[model samples]
Target: MDFGLPKERTSLKIPPALGEEVQEGRVALTPQGVRELVARGHRVYVERGAGERAGFPDAAYEEAGASLVSREEAFGRGEVVLKVARPTLHELALLRPGATLMGFLHLAVAETGLLEAMAEKGLSAIGYELMGEGPRRPILKAMSEIAGRMAPQIAGRLLEAPLGPGMLLSGLPGIPPADVVVLGAGTLGRAAARAFLGAGASVYLLDKELSALEEASREAPGAITALITQSRLERYVAFADVLVGAVAVPGERAPVLLSRELLARMRRGSVLLDFAIDQGGVAETSRPGIYQELGVTHFCLPNVPALVPRTASHALTATLLPFLLQVEDDPLKVPALRQGAYLLLGQKGGHLE
Candidate 1:
């Protein structure tokens, strides 16, 4: 599993930090991951309490051969920095110049200032979302499965009294079940359809690609699949009690499917769960996290899996460990690492563009 890299390239000085203040509940690496890295001769710096929220205590990391250091030391000392979310302004400023930064760096919708700062600092940045070309995004798929499975449960809660019309997702014996319309037929969309169907809701899955629809149908058999068009989208959305926007395009902004006008036509008290918010959202009104507008509940959090931190962290580590092991001083030298990278040595958009 060296991926054909030279012996020296397998070892890296890595720091797994989530910053001084924990913005995300998930940690990039678990204690088990650290132990594996350490056995391979990498120096792992675990920021004090970095994995606490994800249920991995400082003592656990210490026992696994990680040095629990202060936040500043963790960020400043490592040749490569690992994180869950994109770094904040303060966190970005703390990185050592020329250090390699890896995480879910969603650069498409990121601020211009943030991109410029990374360039100025001479950092190499890799995004989890962009990892592996042509539908082989392992990291993105793992997280998307979590978010999609969570959507139905979250929608059920939001559909209760006070927040939404007192309607059950799985209607009573004589009553009709809730109508769930999901946009996109990709990983997240298919998962959502399966979960909602399991919850006893009637699911309608739509995508522009017929092949994707066919695949989703086989995965979630009870779902009613449709080709996305203006007429069909408007029709299904209007009938939806819970509308899920699970649409995504790799390395680009999510396509906006629902306009404000289209959204306004939906029944009052309906719920809109936009899983695509990380890549600019599938609805025009979507903003990060939950909000209320026009009598509809909007849960547009970019990191929905964060709600289940312990589970999310373990899943992330399992998928990310191999990639972390592949990292070398110069990431671009590795083919898989280069595909995932958006910035290399302060320069953006050479291979990435």
Candidate 2:
């Protein structure tokens, strides 16, 4: 598992916030977030080009008192690797076998091959998505926010093409507002609803659960329409100009909320933004695409955060680095579990037993 954005161990803290693409290796932090770590005695390592894509430069890491190294050595030396994407087989192949890995481990429906490999490696995988003990699954929640909030922007753009609605989302004069229908009243769904409503569109929120719909109703107040669905969801699908799919089931494939046959019923240019696309889309037509789909005109965006690396990185980093500092302090917390073989150790040897 890796949200996989990593820094080699170092002992300095950045004094300010770093912007996206600061110059590879240069990550600005709240000087205090770093200073506090130093007070506890920790070292940070930076890979030569890790932050380059995010605009952080190598010099910035040096200035922050971070030693630089090749990606090979950085991961080689680090026990807890922070990353954006889950570690690939090649990445796992490089690990010392019994390593503790953390990030968004979407294991409920993880790729079978990856699961087999992880089990084979004896990995004690702690899913950021699943780590929430009782009521607060924080990491997965953040990822959902990333996908949900961005769904509207993607939908609006796709709907504006000539073959599509061909109109600016907000009208100029006599034209009416864009109509957006949000399915599911969960966190991601609500975020999409709030964003669309704020953007001057007519928003309709539909959910089978009255509790969810009622809670959303309270937030929207008079601004939005809360439709409590007592029957099948068929009628709701027929009326949507833009449909945002935000439903979820932890550790399982996303359930189909809308069928292709049903999707064909929406306005020809109507857009379906399935934020659930990552775990098998809610729509038959939606599936993960190549990175270039950053401009994915039609269908869902599986990796929405990569498109807004600047915001996504900062948000992801904010949550990750603190835990990293703690691990750095108790280096054994990571390597010990790795060495002990009961924790998130990848499935390497029969040692998992």
Steric overlap count per candidate = 0, 43
lDDT of 2 by residue, 10-98 (tens): 22221122222222222323223334444555555556766665556667656665557766655555554544455677766655455
Clash pairs, candidate 1, are none
lDDT of 1 at 53: 74
lDDT of 1 by residue, 73-147 (tens): 777777778777887777878788988787888888886689888989999888888776555988899999999
Most TM-score-accurate candidate: 1
Estimated TM-score for each candidate: 0.92, 0.77
> Which 10 consecutive residues of model 2 have the lowest summed lDDT?
10-19
What does candidate 1 score on TM?
0.92
